[model samples]
Target: MLKGRPLQYFGTCIALLNMLGMGWPSPFLPVLERDPLTSITKDEGSWIATTYLIAGPVGSIIAGIALNKIGRKRSLLLSALPFLTSWIIIAITQRLGFLLLARFIAGIGGGAIYSVLPIYISELVDPPIRGFLISVMGTLTIVASLFINILGYYVNITYSSLICTLPSVVFLLFFPFIPETPNYYIVNGKIDVARKVLSQVRGRQIDAEEIQELVESNEKGLAKAGVLDLFKIASNRKGLFVCLGTMGAQQLAGIVPIIFYTQTIFEKAAADFPVIASTSLLYVLLIVFSAVSSAIVDRLGRRPLLITSISCCCVALLMEGVNLYLKSQGGLNSIGLSWMTLGDLSFLVIGYSIGLLVLPSVFLSELFPLNVKGLAVGFCNIYFSVVAAAVSKLFQITSDHYGLHVPFFVFSASSFLSLVFAVIVVPETKNKSLEQIQIDLRNKDEHNKGEQTHLLKKYCSEQ
Candidate 1:
């Protein structure tokens, strides 16, 4: 037992709860659609996913304001309430209308939790261990996702739906034990409380001078910031673009469609196989692989991991596209023992687990400065949610109109573009301080413009 470090344990527990609650509902989408209570058409089924993604961005934007005003502990407890209620409603109602509404509400809670946790962790933990701790959140979510998919495979629909409620219940019960973020306390001028929380979380008495320095630094940063000030900073703009591009690339990598509609895709393509069982097994395996990838992300550095991951994703997606194209051409229909299809699907999952599935959150946390971190993360999440909604709808529409290969081809092209963007625009931020990153980006931008200016000056002087 790490004495006096209740906050660390509490944070891990909260993260685990949030992940379990949010991720478990995901694998149930296919099963829900198949149930009599929610016999949705393919388009309508996609809307359920769309609703969650749309709600995530909206909820993320609201989270900062809510946390600033209401306080972190209170906000988290309040957020979990909706998920619990939503699960109960889902278990009983069985109406498509009610189901959508419930999912949207649950999504709001989940989104808020996701948007806020990184900021809270950054503020609370020491720098050396922060990456490891934050990565634990991703690991736990993947674990929960794997567990839930397995449960959904064997359990009855009603039971599976009911099982999603456990995390929220656990969250609400345990939330009271965690302390409010020390930064949030400082922001509100509760110095005594902030000091106490910091001491407890750090498992040692923080030097008063150090705490005062932090408070002073925070005050100066806050004083200089205005609503539009983030736009005026070149570093902020660069960071924002990187954040947005990274998030967009993560979604555009096509993992969302694969995770949410795995059973559907399997059924549509490999109807002869045990679709549900195979998909469930693959999801569980991918989650395990994703956790392993996340553990090594910090060591590999952001840029190499991102470039490598996106490259692998592009290749995998292209392979999937080629497979789909072949099937469309009736080349595989005659072959009764086509292990090639299975191999291709495994490649897709492996590519995703190794690359796109693991890096977005890690990149986001590393790239942004603390001053505008919360709002910047919130905005990035907004892009993610919007792209997810659009992609989910696009996958359904494209699959119906142009055949399944079209969507995979589109996703592969986007991944290729993302690889180019990563190489040219994204910086390697391994083991670097946030302030150092800001300086590097600003210098890079100045150097690029300086070269252009010199060329213009030479021409003008000659003319």
Candidate 2:
């Protein structure tokens, strides 16, 4: 177990590094477009982000198949190489064509990392610590994003692009320290090796009974679910709905617009504020809040935090819309009120950081069974990427015609709807085993129908 601790930590670190590589360049894309070598139009620049997400769904599907065959350790190592090459290309290349290709390739790496890492983490840790560890990946990614945004705000673009390479290097260094997941070994029919790997990750010498149970549980799960059988289950239906809903919520939470077009949002909000610097500082502060939220996720549980945080987001978005409405009406006469606008925007950022951004990935990871984990996550990501693309384009259009406030209003409504869906439909998965979760969802579905049947019989008898 002691030997395995290093490997678990190594996996966690690799997940963090993946997020850093994926997220760091996003906030500074405007600067990238503005560079003389590229000199892209605003619409074309937005496509860069769109293209990255376009690859995400496809990459995630590939990663699911690849991880099962190649194993977690090798898949992670291979994913890092593309990220390294992408950074180098962006740093050296003057051609727009090459730069787009590099970004697309980087997106593939990012998408795969996002899809596969959760499954890897799930396979590595015990049920108790799984949520906390998986949630940390997102927390760390936000932190890296915050750090890079600050750098881009203050440093030159060339330096910022170069600095993005460091995390990939860090990942490559740590790759050899982690072991393949026990589940992966079990699937490959290496029972003894699987047990050894399990003992290491659990940080205690697992008993032969426990190892036997794990093997049996995995085999039973596989027996119940053939490779192509995930599509047939009622539980899978709920899982798909939850995955798609959460992914849609995540993108429509107005996060991508904030991350990719921070300067633009700030420009609309605070005309006199230094757009780049202020937006960077805001991202840093919000990221700090996201880290704090991650630490509390397990303690508070998923549902309550999701509800509260998303509700807070709705309020913040409304506040921003109101601020914009007031400004449009020539109502910002006081300096005090002007400063309050920044405060309002910060509230929106913090609310989103705490709720929508951090929880969706954690929830989706817990929602799916192993049989379809990869493909389910990949489909969710496809929706995420598609919405991200749509939102980016929508932001540009709304800002051009209706004003910045229109986008905020749209997001505010979407978040409110998400909160409703979460409360009514999403189950609490905190600390539950995957098998247990599947059973609960099935039972819940059964219970609902039983209640309906009872109500119908009672009404008919009464009539």
Candidate 2: pairs in clash: none
Candidate 2 Cα outliers beyond 4 Å, as residue runs = 4-7, 24-36, 224-231, 334-338, 449-463
Per-structure clash totals for the candidates: 0, 0
lDDT of 2 by residue, 38-72 (tens): 68777777776677777777777778778667887
CA lDDT, every model vs. true structure: 0.72, 0.74
- Give per-residue CA lDDT, model 1, range 190-250, as digits (tens): 8888888888888888888978976875653344344464577777788888878887888
Q: Cα deviation in Å at residue 248, candidate 1? A: 0.7
The window of 10 residues in a row where model 1 has the poorest summed lDDT is 334-343
Measure candidate 2: CA RMSD.
Answer: 2.7
lDDT for 133 (candidate 2)? 79
Best by TM-score: 2
Best by lDDT: 2
